[model samples]
Target: METLPLQDYNIYVGDFDQRLSDWLAEKVYSRLLIIVDQNTKMHCWPLLEPVVSAYQHSLIEIPAGEDHKHLETCQQIWQTMMEARADRRSLTIDLGGGVIGDMGGFCASTFKRGMDFVQMPTTLLSQVDASIGGKLGIDFMQVKNSIGVFRNPQAVYIDPRFLRTLSARELRSGFAEIIKHSLIADREQWEELRQISDLGKVDWPKLIVPSLRIKQRIVEIDPFERGLRKALNFGHTIGHAVEGHALETDAPLLHGEAIAVGMIAETYLSHRQLDLSAEALETITDFIRRIYEPVALDPATFPELLRLMSNDKKNESQAINFSLLPAAGSVEVNRTASPAEIVESLEYYNEIVAVGNRI
Candidate 1:
């Protein structure tokens, strides 16, 4: 097992059974609460059950998907904790993807004025992105992660075995964060990533480590997103808006799928605002397009997209904040783009998709 130590916690990546068992033996929580969604309850819970069942634990399963990430579900978790007679000494084990981790951790942090929680990120997205950063929250009023807190977990347990439960679409959905990590921070990794044409053939554990390291460095420097940490928001500004809107549609986009779209549009912004080389922009766009099927945005929803972007957490003072790439492997945070310019970027993405469709 490989352990990556953060300021106060450690992220254990690899076969987590022994590590989880050892860690549990060391902790003295009054009780353990394992949180899951419908999906994880079936697939991920079994992997965790053996380790945690030896202790005094209860299961809290809720509905799955991004649409359920709200105050209402948190209430269900909180209510379950209450009935379980959990206290601040209780430990919450968030054993699912981003939704479970975000909402579970948020619930734990607020319950009884706060309790300790550990993340067992089942999905690749949570393993690499959500489980770290100590950012916890649920979406409010269709604004993704608008209501949340910055509370570190006791530890993070990332077991690659959990990834086996993921469907192809889900696996691909998680890969967007990996792409984002390389794009913003590691040019060499980005180059290496470009060689990957088949996700099924790639070694995920090897890829996951580097991506985690990239985020580790950034978060360590600016934990609360004061400055450098904003670099991580490269695709999220537009991506979150796209994701929030898609959640209300018949065909909802996964977080990473939506981010793939955001990255394409934001890459266009990078080329326009930062003067990124056309070659570099094209390289990034083409690579992403090859991996993620094109998702065309409706022009009719442009106004709503803009409204969502305006409410993005990263925004400073209504200027529609962005983290633009001046080039691959580097980012500029706190950048503002006018709504007109933002619309143009969205149009650029649509045009690219339209062209690709024709050809």
Candidate 2:
């Protein structure tokens, strides 16, 4: 029911296959390209294909992973779009996770100097979070969202039905963003998620409104991300670094898993330096452990991870800034801590492990 601020753009968020197809037939431009990852091409495209068939739907598939969100990958996608002769009248319907949504939006925003993009986010992560916001970009030098632009989509189509095809890990991954959203703005929304008997068995109708309202309100206030918007990066500071590192290696964790760790570690920072209550941090840590595989970050991988974080684009000069949680539903930004503080934060994170609850 929530609509994007931009005119001529409606974010259709329920079961409306016939209406979606009918609307696409009426509103979308002439050339239609459905950008998707291989996984979505296999799992979700089947359901969406028929709806947009009339607009000369061109299926552009990229490799399904974070490693592919680079200039090289964009080059390939650009070539494919050109091969299809996508013009200004064309619309790119991004049909995948954040990688697809971000890259596809960027591709459309740049190619031909600007084309309309409609997000068709498949994963719970993208639907509830990434797909809506106008922040579009690809990774640069393996940094998370390092190369990109802030171009809103023509529309964002989030169908909960798509979540049925996602792997359990993928669902959990997106839920991290959901948790981040709730933490930054709405405690009641956080409680709704916490009380859910099954995170996977989400009540789509009951859930979509609060999440959309929160994100839309924030974006409306700070579309350019000059100040208030940076708060959205709460779990992302360390989460992004972890994501970049994992991508450098073979065992890359999906973004959400890395963020689950990021949230815990950043919460540690908040607990020690900021005014966040320890009880709330424990509740968050417990929730995360229930959903994700506990990553026991040993001392050996500590320095490299820390270095990767320093190299992150979010840093100002030599100091790395973070959107640390002072409390749930409240974030404090640019609270740059020293490297020693970061190490201590990691140690503090390890201490929070359930082995013997030091606190």
Candidate 3:
């Protein structure tokens, strides 16, 4: 029953059934396309069917997972829309997690130069972060979000009820984003999140709105990422590299998992560059380790990881740029990080986690 407006769209939070039904009762569209991954097709579609069943709709189901989020999948979405005879007035509803939201939004934005799209983000990662921001794209050349745009969706509908369908690992993955939001904007909230002993028992509906608002305020100020928006990419620079590496190697790393690793390394970097105290760094990194077990990284992968990071959209003049934490609740963007510093941070991360596991 809560509504927040973005540049060109409004985001509704709460029971999506009532909200979508009420909105659809008045809005008109030439056609409707519902895009989902295989996981959502099996788990979330039934919940959505009741509200959208009366419309002239079709389902475009792609294989679920980050690996499937690519240009080939986008082509399939475009082909399906073409077959459905969709036009400018048509609507595409993205009905799953980050990949579905990103790829579906990308597909809708590019179809016929742009068709209206709605985001009904199902996963915790999508609802609190990916679904709120207008950024949309697919991985290209094995780089995360290398191909995409900043097109807004027609609307975004978030229902925390969908969190029930996620596995424990998925829920933890999503919680990492909430932690990231708190770290970058609200230190108190970050402390509050750290106090929770069992992530599975979280009250997602209560927790989600604050996280949404944090990103909402930031996105409103820097919709095009000209300045402040990059602050939102706190863990994303290195996170994207880790994510891309995992996808390329067929290793298991959820977006949040990679970002958790990124946050750990970046937190170390914050201590070195931003004067974040060692005490604060240990507190934060310990909490991260408590939740995310480390991902094994080969020494050989550092070169490729560095190469992927160099391709980040935020970089300039080939110097790897980062949105680093000056302190909890404050971030400084466009900080230049040398290659040596980056490797040292990663090594620091490796040492801490390795030692933690031994204890």
lDDT of each: 0.92, 0.79, 0.88
For residues 31-60, write the lDDT of model 3, one tens digit per residue. 899998878988899999889999999999
Tens-digit lDDT track for model 2 on 1-359? 44444443577777658667776767758688888887898888889877776667688989987788888888988999999999998888888988899998999999989988888888888887775568888888666787788888867777878888878888788878888888888887888777754776777646765777787777777787776777887877778877888777768888899888888888888888888888987887777766777766667777888788887777778888888877888888788878788788777667666443432
| TM-score for candidate 2, residues paired by index | 0.92
Query: After best superposition, candidate 1 residue 67: deviation in angstroms?
Result: 0.6
How much is the lDDT of residue 236 in candidate 2?
A: 78
Q: Considering every candidate listed, which one attains the maximal lDDT?
A: 1
Clash pairs, candidate 1, are none
* Models, CA RMSD each: 0.8, 2.4, 1.1
lDDT of the structure predicted as candidate 3: 0.88
**Which pairs clash in model 2?**
137-148
Off by over 4 Å in 3: none
